[model samples]
Target: MAVSRGCLCCVKYLMFVFNLIFWLGGCGLFGVGVWLSFTQSQFSSLPLSFPSLSAANLLLVAGGVTMVTGFLGCLGALKEQRCLLMTFFVILLLLFLTEVTLILILSIYHKELDEKAKDDLIKGMKDYNKNTDLKNSWDNMQKIFKCCGVSNHTDWHNSTGTGQLPSSCCRPGTDPCHRWEEPCYEKAKNFLLSNITSVLVFGVCLGIVQILALAFSMLMYCQILRAEKYMD
Candidate 1:
């Protein structure tokens, strides 16, 4: 009984520490998701759904689930409650499955999604001048990405019905002929792709953590049951 108690204590603290780290990671993910959502809101006119916005939404969901799971795990470990421990395990299992499905779908439809996003962005460009929010967003994106229109500078000509490119399309004090030749869509796509990759990696890591958490929770739950039986 003494050895069992010691072992249980060790496992309890281990679960607590693990969950604390998990919760912190979830907070970071949530913060990044919120930032992305705010920045991408300017492009809301593009489409109801786009890669960056979708990714932000994904992050928010994943983060919220992770935080909830982490909290359950932490409280269950400290209180040694079988119900909370089981709930944590169930939640983690569901979250893991959901992540796997999303990743698979994203991998399969990546090209199609990219094309859709490009089409949407190009379509939105037509209203660039007419929509203050979109215009500012485009200008901000161009400046940040150091790129011009969707496909290239010429795209603006069609969208604006004017040959003049926005000043954001070129470096300050540079000749108009020297406007950025890279497409804003490509740059933005690449940026979002890199972030998605990071998210994928993070998801895998979190899945592993969840598996460990499940193991720990079950182990402690069984130990608690055994201790109660011993007392009886």
Candidate 2:
């Protein structure tokens, strides 16, 4: 009987630590993506602020809050008091819910933005061809679009994307395919529509991972206390 009770107590402390580790891990991964988005948009040479910039900042804020809350939960777990544990748990849960909601809403508008991005690219090339007059000499004619590193047969696929696409690229005769590429383009339109579905999947999986971790961390601490009690 004594051994069984000690084992149960140990398990609870371990659970507390586990919960914090998973929560931090998950948030850290998302944080890098969010930071990258901001840097890519604001610091890049062609960096023009887009409507999507708002969304990126929003994610950053939410992720930060969630991470902090998770950490607090971990601390509370160590204290092993019911009130501290419950408070941290509630705060962490609310933060998670907020993040999931934003991820859903932003996904909706992302599709339309992607289409616009594609057209902008095509129009930019056409305008540049018409605007620039490099003497039209045989030498100039030979390197026309290629003057700006654009080949007549420039392949967007596998090409390094440093091109700035004007909105006019979306006009008729311009190819927008270069802007939104591959499976990402196909899925971007429907990503928001599938937000609810993604939430259900990610939420359940992440929630379980977080819960189990905390449960284990706490279980460990509980054991520590129990063993100490026994020695006493």
Per lDDT, the best of the predicted structures is 1
* lDDT (CA) per prediction: 0.81, 0.47
lDDT of 1 at 24: 74
lDDT per residue as tens, model 1, 106-179: 78998887788778777887887788887887888887888988777888887778878888888878874568
Model 2, 192-218: lDDT tens digits are 234335434755666676666545544
Report how far off residue 79 is in candidate 1 (Å).
0.9
Return the TM-score for candidate 1, rounded to 2 decimals: 0.80
Off by over 4 Å in 2: 1-8, 30-34, 41-52, 106-207, 211-232
